[model samples]
Each structure stands twice: as structure tokens, then as C-alpha cells.
Target: MARCFDGNKLVIASHNKGKVREIGELLAPFGVETVSAGDLGLPEPIEDGLTFIANAEIKALAAAKAANLPALADDSGLEVDALDGDPGIYSARWAGPKKDFTVGMEKIHALIKDQDNMAANFTCALTLAWPDGHMESFEGKVFGTLTWPLRGDKGFGYDPMFIPNGHAVTFAEMEPADKHAMSHRADAFKQLIAACFGDNQ
Candidate 1:
């Protein structure tokens, strides 16, 4: 059995505005009030973890401890098969300090431009931590291929270049609600909902 989240307020442990907004939208149906770590002035902990789940837990626990409230965190990245996942965990770091996804995409394109295999995927790990030290976690992935010249002007990060399987348009080209419906984060959120909310979802 998993620990239930009966709390009304949660701290979203993320500095990325887009992530905060997406998560806030996901949690809306649960009627939970969300406050971002940035808003609360919580310091971002070093993501020294080896995996997405580890990093998510680290951030969630850090915020839960600091705020004395339940905290939710997500660590997501793009993994390219051709590069042997070179930027798997370092996806954000590849974007540089300014968090420029354009630079990140350009680097990826440079590496795999000549290669025939442009296969790639997105991975997301979500962690929920309570003030009492209990924690729950989930993970999700969306398989896709890389596109050239970068399409679309929506979605943050490397969305413009990722074309999910069976989809003609990139994530950056889809509506927010449409992307959310089939995103890796949404897959993980479904598992979290199953574990915490049971059938109520």
C-alpha cells in the first residue's frame, strides 16, 4: 500500500517556470494548492544523483524539509540512442547556464547530423515527499525521433526537435493541453495518481 496525499498544499520543487506551470495544471484536478520553490525562495540542491528518480527524490526531499510541507519534483531529459545517451542526465546542463534549449538542440544536431539513426526519447521521473519523511516515486518515457531545422515555436526546452512516435508534429507544435495529454510527465503523473489517489482519479 502507498501513502496517501491528503494534504491541501504542496511545494513544487522546481526552478523552471514551464515545469511549474505544467505540474500546477496537472495537480489542479486534485484540488491541491501549489507553490513553486522559486516563489518560496528555496535553494536548488545540486543534482548529483545518477538517475532521474534519484534526482527527483533529492529535490522533493529538499523542498519538503525546507517548507515542512509535501513536495513534488520531476527530473526529465532527452536521451538520444545514437549518442549512447550522452546528454541523458545532462540535458539541462547541455543547454548551458542560461538554459538555452536552442544551444542544446544545436549540439545534438551537430553530433547526429550525419548518422542515419536519429532515434531519441524523453524520460521523466516524479517524486513526492512528505514532511514526515515518507516518499513515493514514478517514472515515464515517450519514444520519439529527432527532426532537423527545429520546428514550431511552442513548448520549452528541446521540444521543437522531438517528434513522438505516430505523431507528425513536434511537441513544440502541439497545444499545451495536447502535449500534456501524451507527454512523458503525464505518464508518470498517471502512475502517481494511481498510487496516491487510488480510484479517485
Candidate 2:
């Protein structure tokens, strides 16, 4: 059986402003107080894991230990089929020190220039960990294709360059509620809710 989150306050183990905000909103419905790692003066641990799940667990465990509280972490990235998932785990690193997704997107576009297959997808791995080192993890993905000249300015990271499978607009073009409705993170959250929060569980 999966572990459960019985705590009233949870730490969101991430320093990314966009990610922190999105996750805070997601946790609001549960009525749990959410604090961020950045807000708590917690250092971001190195994300050297080979997979999203591993990385999420690393961050979650680090925060849980540091704060002595239950914590949640998400590791998400964009993967292009043509690139053979070239920046998969290194998605954040591709943005460089300044975390500029514009430069990262340009690099991807340049590498796949003249290529027809622009298939891509977003993957998210979420881990919830307790102070005792016990944990539960979940993953989610939203399939989409690459778009050039990127559209919209709402979302952060590679959002503007990705056109989700069923939508004409990129994620950056959609409203926050719209994006959250079908986001990779949301998909993962569903599994998490079922595992950790559901009455049936």
C-alpha cells in the first residue's frame, strides 16, 4: 500500500517560481498549508539523477529531511522524439545559468531544422516524502508537438514552444486554469491523490 499524507503543512521542494506557484495552487484544494523550499531558506539539492522519478525523490527527501516535514517535489521536462529525448533529464540545464528557455528552445529548433517529425511530449514525476524517509512517487505526461517562433507569454520554461496534442494553442497561450486542467503535473497529481488522499485508499 502507498503511504499517506496526514500532515497539515507540506513543503514544496522547488525553487522555480513558476513551479512553486503552480503547485501551491494545486495543493490549495486539499486545505494544506504550503511552504516553498526557497521561502524556507532551504538549498536546492543537486539534481544528478538519471530519471525524473529519481530526481523528484532526491529533492523531496532532501526537503523532508531539512524541514522535518512532509514534502513534495516535481521534476518535469520536454522531450522531442526527433532529438531522441536529447535534453530529457537535462531539460533545466539546457536553459543555462540564467534559466533562459528562449535560448534553450532556439537550440532545439536549430538542431532539428528541416526535420519533419516534430513530435514531442512533456513528462512530470512527482514524489511525496516524509521525514522518516518514507515516500510515494507518481508520473504524468502530456503529448504534443513542437512549434516554431514560439507562441504566448503566459507560461514559463518551454511552454510556449509546445502545442499539446489536442489544442491549437501552446501551453503558454492557455489560461492557468486551462493549462492545469490537462497538464502533465495535473495527471501526476491525480495518481497522487488516488494513492495518498483517496478515501478508498
Candidate 3:
């Protein structure tokens, strides 16, 4: 069985600053030394997978193979039930190459216009890969409804528009600690930490 993260060096296989920051915070308690893909000058790999899990695994594997060390990767996106789960894997590209989520949010809001049911959710899939091709994966989701005109300015991406279930404020309005505690990424990370650490606590 693998040991807990402890204080070992680990690579966060992502170039996005937002994602890297989130993952860094999540790994803080484990005393893990986190490194981003940008730090290593690693190139982003093609994510041609059909599912979040597939994409996450591909990224983790690529990073691990390239660095010859353990790597962690996550693929997450906003999934609108009303849109037939559209923007699932293409969430990043929905706004084109500029990674502008404003256009993507607008598109989603437009699609659900005048609809009574505006249910949606955020899904996250995380993967940890080793240099020997060994790997593990976990998934999490936070259900919520869509909101209009957006709100808050604390978070990036679609955070301004997504109001999590049972909450009055959108993710963008919430503090990082609060959102991290119940976020889809956090949920998935909980599973990963448990699996890796087991009953060692």
C-alpha cells in the first residue's frame, strides 16, 4: 500500500494558476511539497479523453512519466443537466482558445433561458500516477442551480455564476476555505487522501 503524502515532493500536473493554487492548499496539511507543471517547464498534453477521469489520468501519467515522480492531476467542469451535460469536457474550450469563461457562462445562461429547471453541477475527477504506470482515481460532484447576472469576485472561471445547492451565495462569493471544504475538488481529494493514508491517522 502507498504511504500518506507526508512531506514528499509531488507534482501538480497543471498549468492553470487557479487549479494549481487550489491543489496546493489541499495538499498543505499533508506537508507535501507541491510543484506545478509550469515550474518544471512541462508542456500540456492533449486531453482527448471522453471523461474527466480519463483526462485526469492522462495528465497525471504524462507528468509522472516526464518527471519520473508521483504526480497529481484533476479534470473538472461545470455540467448543466438542462443542457444534456454539455460543456462537460469542453468547458475550457467553450470560450475558445483564450480561456475566457465569460462567453461560456453566457452560452450556458442563454441555453437555459426561460426554463423552469436550471439545475446544474460541478464535477471533478482526480488522478494520482506513479512513474511505474501505477495509478488511482477518484471523483466528486457538487449539485446546484444556475443564477443570473453572476455574483461575487473571489473566484475565477464560472464561480461567479454557480450557486451550490442549499447555499444562498455563489461559489465566487464564498471564502476559499469555505468553498474548498465542500467543493467537488475537495470531495474528490478527501477520497484520495483516505485511500492513500488509509487508517494511518
> What count of clashes does model 3 give?
0
Report the lDDT tens digits of candidate 2 across residue range 105-141.
9999999878999999999999999999999999999
Model 1 CA RMSD to the hidden true structure, in angstroms: 0.9
Lowest lDDT 10-residue stretch of candidate 2: 192-201
User: For every model shown, what is its TM-score relative to the native structure?
Assistant: 0.98, 0.97, 0.95
* Highest lDDT model number: 1
2 or 3, greater by lDDT: 2
- Show model 2 residue runs off by greater than 4 Å: 199-201
Model 2, position 1: C-alpha lDDT score:
96
Write down the worst ten-residue block by lDDT for model 3: 1-10
TM-score of 3: 0.95
TM-score of 1: 0.98
Which wins on lDDT, candidate 1 or candidate 3?
1
